[model samples]
Target chain A: MAQPHDRGPDFLERFVALLEGDDVFCVATVIRSDKPGMPAGSKAIFLRGGGVEEFGFGDPARTLRSQADRALDEGRPRIIALPEGVEVFLEVQRPPARLLICGAGHIALPLSRYAADAGFRVTVLDDRPEYASAARFPDADVVAEDFIPALHALAPRLFRHIVVITRGHAHDLDCLGEVLHWTTDYVGQIGSRRRLAFIKEELARRGFPADALRHRLYGPIGLDIGAESPEEIALAIAAELVCVRRLGAAHAFSLRGRSRAEAP
Target chain B: MTDLALARRLLQLRRDGLRVCLATVVEAAGSTPRDVGAKMLLCGDGATFGTIGGGCGEAVVRSAALRMLASGQGPGLVAVDLTQGPGERDGDVCGGRMRIFVDPG
Candidate 1:
């Protein structure tokens, strides 16, 4: 529903509020147009859950809504054609990708740093106070104790990437049990091949769909970079995270054989 | 900088009851310096924060933004075609087009 101009906050005010809440929204600006009434720069704001909040030009509310929805679905900006030779740039504004590290161990330290530098809002979780302390993870946005409780407390929809690097195999299994069901964009688990296979078999026996687990889980995680040290392993995981973030799981193919010049 | 930083600056300016205009590059074509969604905030006192792109293009947008603030006009758009000749100015030789939406608050 369109908000009345006389009452409530103006467009800018509402826009700022959405930004403060880290809500997903789109700003459709009429960047190029041949018409006079709807000249260039005319704009409209559309929220993901809400309809169009404000529109400067004439009534093309339905078109703007669909365009905004498309931008949100595509997760990228694009020029959309409107009525009367008007073209708008639908700029999608999404919150930064959040990284939820299930364990605040040695790998978590450098992984959190690399993920933060790569623009992911990093949240480190561990039951140990000494490990999850703010002093230990100075760069992490959130350092929470109590792994399972903390996982439950977070709105699963907010976290797009999840990393399970607990100190033990049992902890990794427990973390995966809850994380696999969450609405996450990517899930990576650090372990040896034998441990990962054992966990997968255990999860499969426990009614977790084997197909979904195979599709969603990135076990023995990170690219096959042959990384040994904690720092190198963190780099490998970060690289894999970036690959999945940008190219999606299906497009994440091995670049071993392809020429470096031709590889993206 | 991030868009949140720009939004916070704009919000602070609004709270202070200062007349200001926000110019955002909603569309960028070809090889522009900045990507789409880049922003620049211009206050009535001629103070500027953030940047759409440095040099001639920003100067043009800033001048138009000042005019919008002075005239008390509503939001308007400014299209900067930097695909012009080489003798124009620094940072204007990127051979690109940018559509800046200037909104007053």
Candidate 2:
């Protein structure tokens, strides 16, 4: 293994701070190599907001930076083969993907737990302080405020997954109206087709292209997992969240799209 | 532990001025229990932080890491072949090869 720069706690502290932010980055480590001049233990950290930082990569730092960018874009890690059979492991270090639950109600409880367990920093939001109490969502952050303002203040772009499951159609519509403007991996709303239809019509009136956002939207939220109870529904939502996070939105099976199928 | 947590612990150890031997599975081929980039930190007096898949393979890597930690020894790689001929013991059969890089991080 080639020698790396003396990376102490300062390096880690900065990296952790980045994790807490909305920026995506990459950390490429030269883990195995036979190529001469390629330092086996060197690292190339590509901070998107900042600039590139190389630690003992010496001559091959340039190539590592390119690879890091590609890995960051893909939101995945890969072993890049360099000259003379040297392989560097490039790990995409994006800001922790988060879930924003618009209404902290029955489904939010188990959904928060499941999402947190699945590595999403969850934030449960509601106007009712009692429902949005921190104790209610032990594994998630809680915000007690009106849905739209809370969404705006929290910055919907920071949350990759947004689930709107408010107590009524009005709140859901307001939340979705705010969220559709942001580019998120998953934006779901829990409601019947009629309710969502009204919301979409209202959104179209409010200047958002409802059809344009359809590809990224998951209405009547969650995977078609035959869920009945609140916990099962939360599990379905969490499963959909994982699907969108890992396998991409193309493979996600939303109930809204499969409403024709009868319940099992 | 999560990779981030392990990284934090490694940084803490380095902050304390302790040189720790970190073993990372850089490459794995066929039926390996652990994938590439899996890491295990070997602290002083034989405290192992994580695992690149436990059992005999990890032990072999640990031994190589101990050798790398010796005074004047530089960072090096360890090759472990979990593959064996047919009729090999069932409990030990994973049938893969791993290249582990051990460095003083």
Candidate 3:
């Protein structure tokens, strides 16, 4: 059997190659240490096929697999036992996140562009053929003429982030009524607090759970960046998304002083 | 090949008059296969040129191509709307969001 380093290039090299290839592979590194067998900067790779390859680590394959599997399973970074002076850091690569912008209004226009810039796969939907046209959102992956059917057409759990910026309250309700009950990662709508309240009341009147509605709905959708322009609003939404996705990378890189090392 | 290179090659292929579907991950908010601009190409016959999110995303692109092929023409642009999931506005729990564009060369 070939060792991770002996196999060919180090995990970092292969990791870069895989990322460049657009292949989903995991990166397992030493985030924290109790003892020392692997240093904090130590790393490994986990492919989706359940294979574990390491670079700059111990000879044991089971340990690498065990650690990588843990990270993949938890969807979080993991720390594994190495030697007395070393620890292992494990980061797994999953499929890219999906951003579903359900309205192709002015907000969707910028949101799609900025979201694409931030690295989220974006799909913009609206009932109006004109609003949802491709010309409006050249950066968006998909622009559709309808919403409800499109939402139902997707594979379950495929959309990780959803933004509702449809034309009016009725459309918002139509889109949210279906989406609110599903187990999506994030669901936000664009409107003032009062508008959302009226919408929520209508939804509740129709028997949607008020608590679930409260927890799932994010009105006035964006971080408070004092954004007034369409482009500025897009920036706020994009910034909020980064705040969510880079959580682990930020912590680990700060700890290791590799803040600029791993990022492109 | 790198996604950037693949994207360039795809554009080259497009210039060659081959209808190509270019798929790219423009945004990802959470644990996802690729980052912004991670791209892939899909030829008319289902020959892949690049990748966007990988895994299911690749699968989705394949289907999108078939749809394009069924329409039958030279390379053009087709956008895939993957925002809503089963009874959900946008599906998937990875919490990351992405957009994939399928286009002809």
Candidate 4:
């Protein structure tokens, strides 16, 4: 119930604080209005944590709230039309995607750097202290020594992308097992095609659902770029990660080898 | 410019006890130069940061912002229509409509 004038400091302070956090929010701005009241540039901040502040439109608070919620749900910026020739632009601000690399080995070294350059918050995890040292991964936001403990400590939802690039098949399987059930946007594992098949079969035999691996995993990860070196493979994986992040799995389709008639 | 950088400048200006006007493009139609949420900051000393497009529309907003900063009143919204008059000859024949809100702090 606090007015903008009475809570001026509070509004600016809260805005500065919100900008520092890693949660999504929407800023709704009334950009056009022909009728009286609530002129253009009137604004409101709708926080994902369930709060609205610095609201300008007095009579249409409910409508604005619902519109902001829809923008956040869609995770995109959009313009919503209100009654009486009023249009509000809802600008959704999403937190940067967090990438969890479950092995600070050769590929992860370049992968972390590439992911960071692509705007992801990179976190590297390895069982070996030498591999996970801060000196090795200067680009990573976090370098943790213990894989299982690091995975457990992480807020799974925050880490939208998880890549398992450990030293051996056993380590890859172990890393995948820790995060298989966690809600994530992308889960990729690096291995040969035959090794991926063996790992999937082994996972199926270990009480995981038969379709779980297929449904929730991207094995032999990275697009088919015919990558021969570690850096090239890292680039391929990074490209795939960017594709999945921006386009989503359902919309990301390879156009190679497809006839014009088969193109969507 | 990034929103954080603008916000930081706004905060600094406010903390310095100078009256400032923040103008933002809330609604853009047709072929406006800037998209929605584009911002411009105006200080009392004739200093400006960021921009909501340039030319006549910005000049009009700058005048209004100076007035609002002087008046110390609540925010004012101004609609800029560039579709009027002859194209190219008018110096602002972008053929777009923008609604800018000027909030004083």
| Model with the higher TM-score, candidate 2 or 4 | 2
Off by over 4 Å in 1: A10-13, A20-23, A28-44, A48-50, A55-90, A106-110, A113-119, A133-145, A192-214, A223-235, A253-264, B13-21, B40-76, B82-95
**Chain B TM-score, candidate 4?**
0.92
Q: Which predicted model would earn the best DockQ?
A: 1
| Model 2 per-residue lDDT at A107 | 91
Report, for every candidate in turn, its global Cα lDDT versus the true structure.
Answer: 0.77, 0.76, 0.61, 0.76
Docking band of candidate 2: acceptable
Cα lDDT for residue A201, candidate 1: 82
Give me the candidate number with maximum lDDT.
1
- Which tens-of-lDDT digit does each residue in B1-105 have in candidate 2? 446556777878888987788787877889999887688999766888988999878888777777767674767778888887657663446889988888875
Please state the error at residue A88 of candidate 3 in Å: 11
Clashing pairs in 4: A31-B26, A31-B27
Model 1 steric clash pairs: none
TM-score, B chain alone, candidates in order: 0.92, 0.87, 0.62, 0.92
Candidate 4 regions with alpha-carbon error over 4 angstroms: A1-13, A19-22, A30-43, A48-50, A55-63, A73-88, A133-139, A251-264, B1-105
Query: Pairing residues by index, what is the TM-score of model 4?
Result: 0.63
- Model 4, span A1-264: residue lDDT tens: 322322344556666666656878887767668768777656677876456666555646455777788888997677788888887778887767889999888999999988877868788888888788889998775556567777788888788799999898888878788788788778888887778777777777666654555445776777768897999999988988888888886443341122211211
Better of 3 and 4 by TM-score: 4
Point to the candidate with the largest TM-score. 2
